[model samples]
Target: MGKYDPLGGYLRRLKTDSVDLGFAEIERILGAMLPKSAQRPQWWANQIDPQGRHVQTRAWREAGYDAFPEAGAERVRFVRRQV
Candidate 1:
């Protein structure tokens, strides 16, 4: 593994939080959060469900506990679980 891995030590340095935001919104936040010279971050795998929840596969939408759009995106905020 490398320093840039999701579970790597570098990730701990990210300015993350647990807040609600739409997919598009989270995308913008991630763009701002990452270092300009590093590889782009990607959404955690557990949050996505290719054959299950459609919202997880697509953009964010209001749906009960799923109300937290940031939970499904790669952004630091709203991260339910880490790699």
Candidate 2:
């Protein structure tokens, strides 16, 4: 993995109901700026990457969480699942 796979690390460390983080905060965790696509709604869909080698949503799902980006908002929320 990259030096800063925020989703993986964040999901691993989640121990609360949810986490609300702005793009800047996420970027900090990622150690890099997000791509322009990351700002689009489609990018938040739980889909596979073009290469199909991995599921884009696997990390959060495996961590028993779901992620949602609020419409017209500047932050994304990662909510824990009850299981």
Candidate 3:
């Protein structure tokens, strides 16, 4: 959740359906995973290629990477939304 300091607050707002309309998609995806007590939240990691093309991390997104249950003790938790 680096550079995502506001993400936790944003997620809290989103879970209660208090998010602005611009965050609709994010809300929907997280909401769909509500049944799982422990979820691997998805992340949008940006990468710049040698050609300067910005690419979002599709693999992590698809895998629903978990920032919680953690890879290890040094891991960081991500924002959670009810969306």
lDDT of each: 0.33, 0.71, 0.32
Model 1 agreement with the true structure over 14-67: per-residue lDDT tens digits: 355334444344435344343332122333223446565333313221111122
Best by TM-score: 2
Residue 14's lDDT within candidate 1 is 38
Give the per-residue lDDT of model 3 (tens digit) for 1-83. Answer: 32222333344443332332223333354443222322332322333245633222322222333223233222333332222
Which candidate order results from sorting by lDDT in descending order? 2, 1, 3
Candidate 1: residue 58 Cα off by (Å): 18
Model 2 weakest 10-residue run by lDDT: 47-56
lDDT of 3 at 18: 32
**Candidate 1 residue pairs that clash:** none
Positional deviation of 13 in candidate 1, in angstroms?
A: 7.0
Q: Determine the C-alpha RMSD for candidate 2 after optimal superposition of all C-alphas.
A: 2.7
**For each predicted model, how many residue pairs clash, with residues at least 3 apart or on different chains?**
0, 0, 3
| Candidate 2 lDDT over residue span 1-83, tens digit each | 75335666787786788888897887888787877876777766655467744454666666667778877686888888787
TM-score against native, each model: 0.23, 0.74, 0.19
